[model samples]
Target chain A: MHHLRTALLGVCLLSPLGAHAYSVYVSSEKDNSITVVDGETLEVRQVVPVGQRPRGIALSKDGESLYVCTSDEDHIEVLDLKSLKVDHTLPSGPDPELLALGPQGRFLYVANEDDNMVTVVDVDKRTKVIEIQVGVEPEGMGVSPDGKWLVNTSETTNMAHFIDLSTHEVVGNVLVDQRPRVAQFTPDSRQVWVSSEIGGTVSVIDVAKREKVHVITFAIPGMRKELIQPVGIRITDDGSRAFIALGPAARVAVVDTKTFEVEKYLLVGQRVWNLAFAPDQSRMFTTNGVSNDMSVVDMERLKVLKSIPVGRLPWGVVVGP
Target chain B: MNPAMSRSSDWIRILASLSLILSIGLVRAEPLSIPIGLISAERAEYIPLSSLEPRIEDEGLEGARQGILDNNTTGRFTGQSFDLLPVTLTSDQSPSDVVRDLIQRGVRLFLVDLPAADLLELADLPEAGDALLFNIGAMDDDLRTQGCRSNLLHTVPSRAMRADALAQYLAWKRWMRWFLVVGPLPEDRAFGAAIERAAKRFGAKIVVQKPWTFKAGASRTDSGHFNEQQLANSFTQVEDYDILLVADEADAFGAYLNYRTYRPRPIGGTQGLVATAWSGVTEQWGATQFQRRFLERTGRFMTPRDYAAWLAVRSIGEAATRTQTGEVSRLRQYLLGPDFKLAAFKGVPLSFRDWNGQMRQPILIVSPRILVSVSPQEGFLHQFSTLDTLGYDRPETECSIR
Candidate 1:
């Protein structure tokens, strides 16, 4: 069934409208390159080589440039969308693994896995604004939609630190679970979902109270409990649904926001690490590290469309016009 | 003259009382400091057979230090602080005296990296009655059974657990036949006995069992390779078997028997493929970042002993973080309670056994350079946890910790 849909999509891409289709950019950690895939055709467009170990990629708010975290080289490489070439480098403190752009897209919050600090860099100026000290081994970064807060999840400390934008200090902290890999705020900015990779649970924290409101656990029949590691999390723009990427389980759990219950599991590639949605929210793309491919999901149907081979150890993804 | 002098002294006493009251209020406003003591003894260093292996001066101490750093990171937000006070015993120093001094200093949590005898001596001290000791070095099975103490908890895996872990994997591979080779040392014999128990429990047969009595000479000399090769070949010539199960914990001849066995069988015991709590080759389940952090901090690969020491300190940190107290009684209750579970880079949460005070954890079946599998291998299940299958279960435990 998926192969037939992929074949139909390929046929549709041959139309004239597909020439102006949006592009999906994926960061490959092992290949140290950015794979450009045509959104309309679900085909590989280009494999632009970048710096060493690119894991996190973020699209600018203006949708003109892509910021790729070259973790091993301890810097962020800026790739111009037009030329698909390396433009410049931002000073990321040390071993930047994942990053999040602020709501206005002026400052980029980079999580330095080695130094346990979040480096906020000015994209326009190409300089570091400040380094906010956080817990040990910070990996995940998220910014509130209202531009009032930045949440960083430390893998070792197992806490989501709420950094006040005005003061640049950790105003509050919520202890979630072990080895939190992602901190994602809801569209309404009232709650944040933190994924614990080892604890195998997702904790929902109330933004106002800075306290955990609910804990979401997953249980799959005939599957070992340890393999249900929750990593990447994405909530729809309407805040009605959520998609959680279960690492090494090869499944993405579809959760309803209202009841906070899992509705279904969509099978994806192996070791799915992160995911991103298209501009219209009609489709989703996931980076599967072990399989070296990206699984495209038809969001409306809640089914996997196809898996497109990309590069070795694909870690992060972002869609751009 | 006497009246004036007495009036001045009365004013001084009142002023001192006022200052004491203000200082008490200030101290109460500060964060509570929890100091944990780490006691270990120096031993004669033995050179490893492989030059790639590093000779570390602070094997377990570095792990304890890393644990303290990790605890402090969490403590920053919790409004608590942790400190590690370590003492390395010399040739003439006694462990009991050190325990007494630490107890007097009001340290209630201790991580001891000593042999079973010295660990028991410190646990028996009257001054340590209110203190809790974590064994991070000893792996003797007796310490978990008949020699258990009420106040002592073991973070290190026992020999029986390691043996069972290996046996389960071997059984899964259907390697039923075995040629067992035991070393001459007492520790080797104890390990060999555990292997025997595991073979019986897991439904494997030992085809031929023999003791290795060869005395190895200087291994770095020009003629060392020839002599060692001949010794391993002659010692391993036995009846037909699937694999050679060796018990050489002292590292005397196990490494030499890797490819020198007469029957061309695989080695599975303490040498070629071993079961341990932790190894450098283990990098899954978020252990890669942990290995990187440890390497950047200590410039050495983490050993099993280091991991045990780290687990000991992290266990206390987990307890104190949950209970928010430095009091001995409260932390002890919290650690042993059902609410306690530690995330130590393993795939699952590790907890202590109520019957024996031994920790329940998954054993890593690793070769020297890669991880083969983790046991409590699939299909080996217990009524409670699958980890219970790797060690002494509750019904089989002889320990009665009150």
Candidate 2:
């Protein structure tokens, strides 16, 4: 049973079909390109050009399709992993920054940074179906697995807008720290952690009760809030740990999920912005902006194992099974 | 030695070693002391030498420097210190040259008040990659558009930044119709062109363009001087223009067009509805401390040049505080990080464009006596700040500085 569990966890990603089908995808806001790296080799494989000022990336739950939000394009590009071809474009809100797929994989929620609106698109149809207006500069979005709550963050207001998936109505509003971006839920959906990029803190909120339970502030001071701006947040599949991308620190912070405490810092390349973990859970990769590289971390040791030079200003990453 | 005594001595040695190791551990655990560098011109520019024996000018730079000093002091109780290195250079020197020279001096954060070409020159030098340039001057609107560079960060308001401010208020006032009056001087023409661009960008109309000619306290052979009624009657044919925009940069005619017009209308030029780099009224509204510091330090009034100088120094402090290292490379990383933002007296925070390295923030509008308003209006908002809405939107930007 022990071997079986390990095999299920590790071999799931080593499958013959999923292999070579999709490389690691990352978005570069500076170069306006998406870099793909071979998951197994951890080597930069290809660089594909995209719309003006590309920023956010989202892979379909099935891992066959990936969606990229271009800030200047006012549209989302859908890519088919099998053919590695640009599938189509869907009209999006202006200046899209971050996005996520709904639990059912039927819809994509795009955070339009400039328009202060969240655009919802039906993935199958590749069409924008609904536009929900939020606060100023709406960015970073996540939906509960049960499709009960849709939470989005407003950077300027430093608050989270929570809407009911069923009613499509704003359920409640909770103030987080300053300039909140990027959010993630625990495996069981018991908690939601949102990274306040400008505030340099992460607010871990209770999903069921919809309130902030704890705020993880970096112990160091004098570091500009920009240096502590937390851009990415990810929880382990087992919900035992969480990882946050520290923008100016150029590294990833490991937090123990149970204690809600920052456990350690794993140094990456320069200006680490966003990251993703391999499906096997053996490694995690981050896009380093200034260094123009991708940092591969050996998760077991909680250290940056290697750095892969990539296209200019690598800002987003998504790993596929 | 006795056996018991020898054992005691050995224990003491071990304790000493342990204590040494523990102290080292404590030092590492404590917060780090970081160094920051402020790079500017080691020499000054000749700006027509307005005042006698004028060595210091730049009020805007002074305001920015004071803002950083005040903000960084907040970190003292929290354990952060700031050190500034003041540099000034002549126009003959290259900005990249100065930037490299400062890197050798342990300077990595740069605040710039230079020509755009000089700013782009930062990319040519070998060590230029190591430092961050905070742009505080050279208000060409194109810097945020086609001329953007990643190595440079802008804090000083661009011409468009100010124009956007003017547009927002004008739009709110429903002053859609405009009567364009242009002066001949370069400064006058440039300002008028910017105002015209803003008029179009914010849904305004240009009913007519009137050319004004004056020799600065001298005119034609006629005996008439500062003819208010004749100048006002120039607009008699077109009663359609709502606001008369004078672009008399030479202060030749625009200064008097206000209220002296044939009809009761708003006159905006070098006088009414004007845009400038820095305003004296800025002394109020959180700008008092900046004024105080400049007066205390230099015993003179602050100028726009001073604001640029201050922003240069402050950018270094911000970068140094974040990376907690005096090293140039680390400072660059921290300075460009998305979380890296700067707050100035302009009442908003400025952040760098990772692609272009332009500091994006608000631009203030000042009437002769008061700070009238800020651009993009309160309602115009972006994901970052509503103040950003006034400047170039990401989608409209053509700066491909990656």
Candidate 3:
């Protein structure tokens, strides 16, 4: 009887339908909902109604809770991952757009775009810890891998401010291209990358020196310079390649991390805003804000395998098991 | 050593390290202040014709003030600060003397809000040799064409650009024939010339051209409103045309022709549907925040002059931040350099045309209520950039300034 049961389990694991093990959650800015997709199969499982103006999203460190920045409501909604429901609300400052998790998920750094401040929330206590004043129209938030520094990018100010985690104070600020929308820390925590939407350049900052070390520019055949706006940046966990979503250009540029050169531009959906990776890093998904769908790309072949309809004006995406 | 004494010594060591780190941080942050000058000739008090038009008190100065605040926000992070030195000269005061005094006071970047003639006088001053002058008020096409100055960059669109912007929209709408009405003013005649030039360039036919000689009615009272309709009706009776284009730079009888024109043709050019560099109706491309901030700051709407002045100051601020210096020559070179682009809440990054020193931007076509369209319209292409299609392209420019 044990041999027969083991053989049956092995057969089930080899089947195609059994490969859907991951889930992708996307925040829709217009529809005010979170669309959940079966990561592997590219199927929409549910469209969970969220707060007003759901934009930036991030999963908890343990992947058990999801936080959605409801910019219109001026609050962060904590959604229960297991039950797929709003567990509670955390206090965010005015007009929260994007957020990042501090070291060990101890603090949630939320960028209040209108107020020009970053609201640091104590995740476990569900309380507002502090608000650090930053530059004008702060949008992007990034925490170093070691959790020692938090970087906030302001659009109008055209700068990336580095806040010390221990002191919760800004220790340094690095200027970048115009209207930087997102900042990402490499997995190894040696460098920080920022994508400027209007400037059309990605600035790589040396973490220790706190200055721009390199600037990556993108060019696509037959595309105008104004349309090649670099918005979302995601460096793979292995630190070998970085994927950047060029907003309004409808393409993603895959850059080699070691060489700092653009290897290829993968055509995606229109006005892509953000991207997420499967837990195993074998697949990637991009939220197309204008097209109202998500493009699922196969990492191995560097091709968009399918696009699944999600919600209106999808802004951000995050994946979990 | 004794245990208690050793513990006290360790405390002192820790405190020493803390103070050392704090001192290093302080030494690293040396703030630099960049002083900018605002030069404008004092104007007579502007009185509106009616209550419908709100009197703008701080037209150009308020915009510069707001721009200073914006620059400082970024400057605080970059260890740089911007200071505005505004000097409004009286009619009797010499612009050369004022500019020399400013240079003595260590001011290099200037925002000049003066008429075309006064601007040329200021630009010709020897004391203004090292200063980078930004023209935010003058709209004369000659300043951008044959009379262009190397040191001056005009933020305000030239008359030709505005005329071309309107002409492109009309062409896109297939309104190929136009009836032109010129007002009774020298500036109005200049605008009329620009309109005719734009029509010729855009392949439009001016079926008939006439001058508006009707006396403007004082429509502030009930009796005045009674004769306004009749006066406007008689003023607009012209030959067959698709659109009635008016050149009323004086704003005398433009508003009255909106609903009172014969044949019910849509009015454009200086009234009704108009093309402007900036408008209060625009809310796209993250401009709502700017509008809200301006409203909160001044308790009034932003005018075109205010927007132009703001952009002038912002250009200086952006150049200063990028070059990391307040030196006038360096900032000027960076501005005219090919890599210079300023994101001024427009969909596209704005840059200066090297030939004419005019900032190339997409003009907004607005109705009274909402923004209708943005020009440099579809199918209007340039060899380099679509923005070049709006104004005098490189080949057509006659500017001799180097």
Top candidate on DockQ is 3
TM-scores, each model vs. reference: 0.88, 0.48, 0.89
Tens-digit lDDT track of model 2 for A24-96: 8988877877888987777777778788878788887666667888877888887776676778887776667
Q: Which stretches of candidate 1 lie over 4 Å from their true place?
A: A1-15, A46-48, A290-293, B1-28, B172-174, B400-402
Report the TM-score for the A-chain of model 2: 0.91
Candidate 3: stretches off by over 4 Å: A1-20, A48-51, A62-64, A80-87, B1-30, B48-53, B400-402
lDDT of 3 by residue, B93-151 (tens): 98878888888988878889988888888787888887788999988988887788888
Mind giving the per-residue lDDT tens digits that candidate 1 earns over B167-260? Answer: 9999999999988989999899989999999999999999999998887755778888898888788877778999898999988888888898
- Can you give the lDDT of residue A110 in candidate 2? 85
Q: Which ten residues in a row have the lowest lDDT in candidate 2 chain B?
A: B70-79
lDDT scores in order: 0.87, 0.68, 0.86
Residues B1-402 of candidate 2 have per-residue lDDT tens digits of 999999999999667534433432322334344434444554444433122435555444455556455434422322344555545666576666666777787665666655677766774466866656667766667777877765666766666666667777878888888888887877667777778878878788888887766443433436554564465566434667777877775455565566767777887756687655465567422355445556776677666556655655555655554554556666666666765655445533456555555566555567767878765574654665565656566677876554
* Candidates sorted by TM-score, best first: 3, 1, 2
Report per-candidate DockQ.
Answer: 0.30, 0.02, 0.38
**Residue B375, candidate 2: C-alpha displacement in angstroms:** 22
